[model samples]
Target: MPSTDDLGSVVDAAVRARLDDSGQACDAAERFIVADDLYDGFVEKFTAALLDRRSGAPLSSVAAAGTLARQVAAAVAAGATLHTEGERRGAHFPAGVLTGLTTEHATARQELSGPAAMVFRAAGEADALRIANDTPYALGWYVFTTDSARAGRVAGGIEAGMAFVNGVGAEDAELPFGGVKRSGSGREPGRPGIEEFVGKKLVRTVA
Candidate 1:
């Protein structure tokens, strides 16, 4: 798992990259779930970025350019507020990182499509686990801790297709990638990836 220092650095990067002009693109902004006590800097940077009017071209050109843009636009129209950074209404919708969110909020229940984040605060590890498990979607899971054993425990406990313990940036082509519950039903890459296509047949003989 990413240690407190790594977590802090990631948040610090987010804080530093608060705007398009600040040399950080939307993708660079990692959707986070840091502790409430350790969120002062994250909140500041994320909020600032969310509210600021970003000025830059599309990330790609070949396909639909404003698909994500349209999604963000529609979300804003649907009464979602940018409480932290940037303007409430604008064409350039900077990444919306919504913190202080609870189970009552709709985003907490469903998967977010755009560059948005729903940060929830848990009282303890059990609370964090409960909160994490409460969601139906489990495409990917990120765990950050200094303890290797604790990381193993958390990683094993999480219901996800891919669980990266210490680092979020690590991805092995040989490793299986898939999700459980609603977010996933099949595996990708490695042996499991190949096995996903092979149909299992069981012949029952009555004797």
Candidate 2:
């Protein structure tokens, strides 16, 4: 993960994709696992970018906002550092970032269905992959690295259904959209996805 050539692009893409749909998308990135070499700088820049672009947009519902608020509080209570804007107001959930989270924390495994992200400092590529795959849910994963071989290796190692490398907005009807583990059981688009909702019955007519 430390092979990143452009932190600016990584930060930009991460912010846009994560905040898209008010950070409520099932595939939105909720956890950021940065290599120890680039963890602090990435966090500083990513947080600043998040705060700058955050629109204070209301979530899908008041209850949704309340749920996110509670999740953030629980993460903090679990010993994760929080950087957020004030507090929740109605359905508006402030974008925030949680740091100092280890794989042992319950918040590390839970999904934040709002404009909040958790960042973990990884020892290196192996640790980064470990952290990325630590959760039970594995819908989507993003990798930013300049090394082509490392990129391919990391992409293959990620435990998600879809792995986007060095970019975002890869979702399309042509691509199989789904996740492994607790995220879901089947695909929803592309070739394989078409079979997820269809039932087949054998009909034989003797001629």
Candidate 3:
């Protein structure tokens, strides 16, 4: 099991990396732009929830929202890519202590709740699209995507060197695995895995 400190580092690293890849600059235009204040609020809240989950520190709705916003702002300043599924018409979150924070962006027609929905709505299309294209973190260090085009892009992405799109969940003895950028370097498994346990020797015959 990973330690809390290790997990925190992982979460922070992932968050920072995503923010950097978001491609959104922290200029006055972006900072003061009130066009999507509600959506922005939602994004901040959702980000906080995820961070809290990773850190084992459950944050209150209000606290999460504030933390999320601060984190996003910091991420934007540092350049991180945000990802979402886009908005849906009929989404709702369960009522709880965080209900206020949950439905803060509820419009008269649409009552937005759930973290996923909030993220989608807040990120909008452009940032969401950027995330879909740039997010390198996948399930268990494996790249996850159903789009071939996006898969190709991720394969060549500055952050991901090897991406497996819709692959099986088994590790093969003959296969290799590795990553690029912050993910890590070098390969493992199959011959590579064995090589790590042995020394390489080249033999020649002299006549």
How many residue pairs collide in each prediction? 11, 0, 11
Give the number of the best model, judged by lDDT. Answer: 2
**Winner by lDDT between candidate 2 and candidate 1:** 2
Best by TM-score: 2
**Candidate 3 has what TM-score?**
0.32
**Backbone steric clashes in candidate 2, count:** 0
Off by over 4 Å in 1: 1-3, 12-31, 45-92, 199-207
Off by more than 4 A, model 3? 1-73, 76-161, 167-175, 181-184
Per residue, candidate 3 scores C-alpha lDDT tens digits across 108-206 of: 112111231112221332443343234333212223333566545544542433433333233466866655544465567778756776877989999
- Output the lDDT of residue 199, model 3: 75
Q: Which regions of candidate 2 deviate over 4 angstroms?
A: 197-207
Candidate 2 has which clashing residue pairs, if any? Answer: none
TM-score of each: 0.67, 0.93, 0.32
Error (Å) of candidate 2 at residue 59 is 0.6
| Comparing 1 and 3 on lDDT, the stronger one | 1
Model 1 score (lDDT):
0.55
